[model samples]
Target chain A: MALDGRIEQAVVAALALSKGADAPPRLQAALDHAVFPGGARIRPTILLSVATACGDDRPGLADASAAALELIHCASLVHDDLPCFDDADTRRGKASVHRAFGEPLAVLAGDSLIVLAFEVLAQAAGDHPRRAVDLMRILAQRTGMPGGICAGQGWESEAVIDLAAYHRAKTGALFIAATQMGAVAAGQDAEPWEELGARIGSAFQVADDLKDALLTPEEMGKPAGQDAAHQRPSAVAEMGVAGAVSHLKDILGGAIASIPSCPGEAKLAAMVRAYAEKMTPVHLSPVRG
Target chain B: MALDGRIEQAVVAALALSKGADAPPRLQAALDHAVFPGGARIRPTILLSVATACGDDRPGLADASAAALELIHCASLVHDDLPCFDDADTRRGKASVHRAFGEPLAVLAGDSLIVLAFEVLAQAAGDHPRRAVDLMRILAQRTGMPGGICAGQGWESEAVIDLAAYHRAKTGALFIAATQMGAVAAGQDAEPWEELGARIGSAFQVADDLKDALLTPEEMGKPAGQDAAHQRPSAVAEMGVAGAVSHLKDILGGAIASIPSCPGEAKLAAMVRAYAEKMTPVHLSPVRG
Candidate 1:
């Protein structure tokens, strides 16, 4: 199956488990809204790609890991868009979960998705117990405190924010989880994939900062310039748009170079290059000018 | 160690894992405040006791299960007290998490705790991978949709609520997790223990409804009469106070009768009896009249 179809199937199956007759309709609807019409799904794609590069020994576990990472990412988006935080009115060209479902159901939906992620991993443990545990650990480490998305969100409230650490936790953690979890799911050592994940993740953040600074809401399909509105630390703010773009290019080069020796290394490098080109600031390109 | 001490240690250790130097101070404070000075520690206590009754074979996994159950319960209370929900001012005689940490931190703290629960379980997966997976499944099943606490909370928003299903999902689910997880952690069948958990959980809800309708905030250490305030379905509302009290007694009787045959069955029976006595409405006694 195609990566998007596999991920969508996994997510749909997981959500269906919760849709008993007595299940709360609003919460269910909010969950579907938050998941469907997903963004680029870059994180899970990287995960599945890495798993394929590592030989894709356990297909079920790999699909579950990819689905779990996306679910956590989706949950974070829902929570981040809450009135108490960025208060985003729209996401992916539609109303944010809170805007559509009300804040209470949004909170519950985010929470339900988080639990659903773990439940998916646990259910996939039927034959590959060790791999399942590794997947769970990676997902939890990236989703929670100390160096997860939770820590990333926590950084916003701090008097002092370490720009690198903040970006890594907030955006890079899940990306890193994608790479490492993919390798582990394929029965390979996850360490070799760490640097690749970090570089790609950092590049992705820099690219996002550029978009947040330069794109209009119409262009981005979400609120724009949120970095400035929230007074949040951003690569564009610290380095200027041109400098941030240059940094993104440097990180993408490093990410391509960091791909480890594997049977599918060439294919993986090609995928990273593709993402690099896609995320490049087209308007800033001299050729475009 | 005593059950309370074991549970306390597990929770403290889990929170400590998140207290990196970079962790947000306010979020950390809120997480601590939500957990410390916990009210009764009822859920973990039941979990540990059930594990003991099942032979306490895997002590580490059992302790982790107990702690995970309690952490999830704490997280729910924090979210329940949010402004969009109860907007309560106090919990366990202290300011609620949102009241103390502000709504943003409260949401983050709750999210952090939920992830922490799974992290604790994942960390315990080393020697007993299957058991760990089982524990995770039971916890997620009770914490998420269909019949989880999330479903319970969702029931409140529905136009029609099935009181039994609502109570079971909202309150009974965790209790079921406590029993089932304990058994699974001990390498025993979790199914046999389900009825015991369900009956006890249902009984506890009735007792709580009675307290909410009859007691003062000072007595409950939180806002009272919230069911009526929110127009939520409650035993006291469905059946009058006297009828609710009688129902509680009957449920407790069934709970005691539901204890499955095990080596520690006698001790488990004694524990249930003590809880039943403690939760019995004092004013309903003839001696009090």
Candidate 2:
């Protein structure tokens, strides 16, 4: 199967475990609502791409890891949209999980997804126990505190913020997990894959900053100019749109070059380049010029 | 070391990972506040006790498993107390995580603890990969959907509640995890331990219902009459005071009889008996009689 197909199948299979007949219908429905019609699916795609590049000897583990990473991302969005957080009314062109399912079910759904992510990994661990354990570690570290998305969010509540740490954790953490977990899933050293993910993550963050600064809410699907509205530090805010665009190109270019020497390094490079093109299309190329 | 000491040490060590210097200070404080001076530490204590009864060969894995179970329990309490859920002002006799650190941090702290629970198990998985995988599976199944604590909470949002499923998923889920995970950590079959956990969990639920109905908020150290206020179904609502007490006795007695044949069967039975005594003390006997 292609990456998207495989990703969808993995997600479906994993969610089936949570959608048993006995499950409370609303919570189960909330899980579906949070996940399906996913936005971009960039993280899981990156995970599978890396896994494939590294041989993907254990396809089941790789697929589960990819799905697990994406589930964490989705779970974060659910919590992020709660009334206490961003209070986002819509996401991915639809009502946010909390908006659609009510706050209590949304919270349970997010919590359920987090647990289900590990369950997915654990279920696939039977044949390749070590790889599964590694995936869980990476997922946990990237999803939780100190240097994870949760920590990234936690930084916002602090009086003093570390901009670099904030961006690295808020977005870079999962991308790093994507690359490292993908490599580990395919029996490769996770350390060698970190730089590639970090560069890609930086590129994506810059692109997001540019889009938020330049695009309207209609163009972005969800609310736009949220960075300025919330007074959040952003690449565009720190270094003008033109500068952010230039920096994005630099990061994406570095991402392609950072691919560790693997059996399919060329293929992975091409994939990253393709993503870069999508993130920074021809229309915006002349904006910096 | 004693069960309490081991449980505390394991929790501290596991949390230390998330409490690194780089962590957001308030978030770190929230994590500590959510866990410290814990109520009875009963879940972890039960886990350690079961592990002991089954010959805790892998002491590290058992300790980590015990802590992980308790963290899940604590994480549930944090979310359950959220304004979106219980809208509670206090938990464990202190301002709830949300009340103390605000809603966003409370959400993150709960999330961080959940990830940390899986990380705890993963960190200790190196030596006993199979056992660790088993532990993870059990934890996930008991903590997430259809049969977990999250599912238990999900039931509350439904129009028609299945009381058995609600009770099973709610209080019974973690108790089951404690017993089954304890057995798995000790390299025993988890299936055999389910009955003991279910009965014990049932007993605890009945005891809780009785306390909520009979005790003052001052005695309970938190709000009372919540079940009546919310109009939620409970053993007390169904069976009244005397009937609920009799039912509690039946369940606890059955729990003792349900202990799976193990090396430390006698000791395990004694521990359950001690817990039952504490749960149903002398003062309450006359009210039911």
Enumerate the candidates' DockQ scores in order: 0.77, 0.85
The all-Cα superposition gives candidate 1 an RMSD in Å to the true structure of 1.8
Error of 2 at B80 (Å): 0.5
lDDT of 1 by residue, A207-248 (tens): 888888887899999998888998888887888877887888
Clashing pairs in 1: none
Model 2, B40: alpha-carbon shift in Å? 0.5
lDDT of 1 by residue, B63-113 (tens): 889889999999999999999998889888789988887888889899999
Off by over 4 Å in 2: A286-289, B286-289
Q: What is the clash count of model 2? A: 0
| Reference-based lDDT, each prediction | 0.87, 0.90
Worst 10 residues of 1 chain A by lDDT: A280-289
